[model samples]
Target: MSTPVTASADALHRAATRKAMLRLIPLMCLIYLLSYLDRTNVSIAKSQLAIDLGLSAAAYGFGAGIFFLSYALLEVPSNLAAHRFGPRRWIVRIAITWGALSAAMMFVRGETSFYVMRMLLGAAEAGLFPALMYMITLWFAQEDRSIAVGWVYTAPALALLIGNPVGGALMQLDGSFGLHGWQWMFLAEGVPSILVGVLLWFKLPERPHDARWLSKQEADLLTARAVSSGTGGGHDASRITLAMLKQALLKPFVTLIGAIYFFNQIAFIGLIFFTPAIVQQMHVKTPLLVGALSSAIGVGSVIGVLGVPRIQRWLQRDCLLLGLLTFGLIAGSVLFLLVPTLVVRIALLAILAFFGKGVLTLYWTIAMGRMQGFGAAAGLAFINMLGLIGAFVGPYAYGLAESATGKASSGFFVAILASVLGLVLVPLLPAALRRADAEASQSQRTSARVMTADSPVV
Candidate 1:
């Protein structure tokens, strides 16, 4: 009888996990793909935007970077709102507002309007990633967390891989309604997010318990997993207190995660904002060709994000994998500077994408493992907010380098230096995270004992 029960439980777990993945991951991927494209499509539009607005490289960079300022500032609050209101409604709100703001880019007629619109768009999109991370924590178990994150993260790479060419093609509609190609791209891309946000209202559940598609057994199993994993399903997951927030903020691992992410974004965001310019500097003149080549180079990011699970098995250590990735970023940046051939340059960018974007899942998985409940919600947002300040710095620094030197490749110096700084910090992650995990386990154990003692006897 006991054996039968054990077998039954195992079968249910497997079936439920499969269903959860099917219902959630693809939609999550689609949402992120749209989100990423809306934010970074400015890159493909840079040349024309600059010409029309009479903006220099530095000014354009400043405007692009300003988005992150508003984004980072509002990230924690936005996430807290999502945590309180339920991600189902909050995420929809974020999506619709951001989509509208993004579409409004079509109306920016000057540098000032450009900066203002970009910042508004940033504010609207703030906390979307952390909210999604929080949702994943509520849904996935510890062992499967990284794999789920990898799949969701692949969407950004896919956004670049697919959206680039689509954007270039849409740009061809520049004069269709007397709007510029860039304007057309913005309007076309932004509308989908709004439609998708509405669809999510009907499709997405507030929590595992609320999932109508899941059988009672599956929902119970998932909720049990969430509670045991400290991901928050019961009373403990309810409200984040002042002490909890303070404690999370003071953790060394949290600080380290923020620092490492900051440095990494300097390279990753720099690449996103400058890749087309870098390609154009390589003498790829046409917008269509530039988009095609940029998309081709983005293939490495897709490979890197999708390969995390297998790569984790091969590496057997997140720290080691992280070290290797950062080193790869450094090597690729150095080579991109040394190599003048167009093919080699594109290849180096691909390599950079591999290492730069690949590190995201590894680091996020590590961070998420140590957080649970509303703490996970607030903590993820805080770390993301702190780290993304570098996103601002990255574009502005690269733009300054480009403007000062009149050379696109000169901007790579920022990437190289930032990656090296991140590498130096990699050695600290293991110890910090280990300490955090141990503390979290002890707290979970204590909570379990308290709940067990309070339970009514069968």
Candidate 2:
């Protein structure tokens, strides 16, 4: 009787743990969905906003792209701040502030106001992704992390799929609720994030220690696993100083990875920021339909993010990336140069997007695998910082190239160039890391077997 009761209680606890983790996935996805919606709504808004405000294409492009400037500057510090105060406070604060600023777009009648609001949006959102990444580090083990990260990261793509059409539809409503369609677009998309922010304040567990669903034994096991993995989480004043920053910045591996991400972002951001406009150039009858077609990329991204981790598990990590990069080069070239038919172009764009964004999962996994201690967060921050520089350049360069050539096709060539550059850089990474990863896997399997053999019966 006693043994049966104990087994039942253990099962109940396991179920509860699973339930808690499952709940977090949707909430995190929703949070990121809103974040992307708020960030990229400006792109869709540009359709009506430029005409309404009498702004030039270059000025509009500048305003749309400048959000990353403040975001890049504050990312590391903001991540550290989130680590210090805990996600519950900082994440909620970020959400509320960005949400309100987004809603404030209703009053902007000129380019200056647009630029100011965008910068404010950037400052407000600076900490979000890094903080979320930190949160994932806390909740998940290293082996489980890539898939979890992929799901959270897929939210932006999902938002693009949903938000573009929604924004386009809202923009069609010229004067609803005593505001223009663009104003309504901002209000509708932005206000929900604030509400979700409040909900997150109540819902998010700050750490495993605080998670009611986790048994004391489970929490202790988690902390022990982290320590053994060399990612233990006590606040260390020593790690936050300038010396640590200098060391992280100076590491050759770190710099190489950062450079890789920088070039990768040029292609990624170019596709995302300009896709709708490109689709429009194909002479789609309605802006809303074009927005929906643009969303095909997001659908492809979701498939990529979910699929890459399993691919990495089957193929060696480096080999998987090599294949992805090859696919990217081929698909991107077709999208840019060969396919003249609109339907074929859209299908090929979807294929390119699926593989292109899928590679990011592997990129992040490789970076995290290389780091130790405080270096994990610092390294991720550096890569993102470098990536944002490319993010800033990609859109504006595409716009400028489009204007210069008087053809939208010119932008695709730039994307193709970036994809080819990424393919060239992948081989430069250390081959030994791949071998080391394989050995680590073997050791982990042996340990798991021994642990299973040694556990005592109730």
RMSD to native, candidate 1: 2.0
lDDT string for model 2 (1-458, tens) is 69997787556545544554686778888888999999888777666776789866566667767787778888877776776677668989999999999898787889898889888898899878767766766665566667777888789878877878998888888776577888988988889999999999988887778877777866765555545554554337444778776765666666766677777777777667778877888887676897788888888788888887778777765544655665575567555577679888888777777777777777666766555446666667777777777777777767777777765556677677776776676676666455555655886799899999999988
Q: Model 2: residues >4 Å from true position, as ranges? A: 1-20, 233-235, 319-323, 326-330, 431-458
What lDDT does candidate 1 reach at residue 100?
A: 94
lDDT of each model, Cα atoms only? 0.86, 0.74
Cα RMSD of all models vs. native, in order, equals: 2.0, 5.4
- Give each model's clash number: 0, 0
lDDT of 1 by residue, 19-92 (tens): 99999988888888899999999988889988877878888888888889899999988998888888889889
Best by lDDT: 1
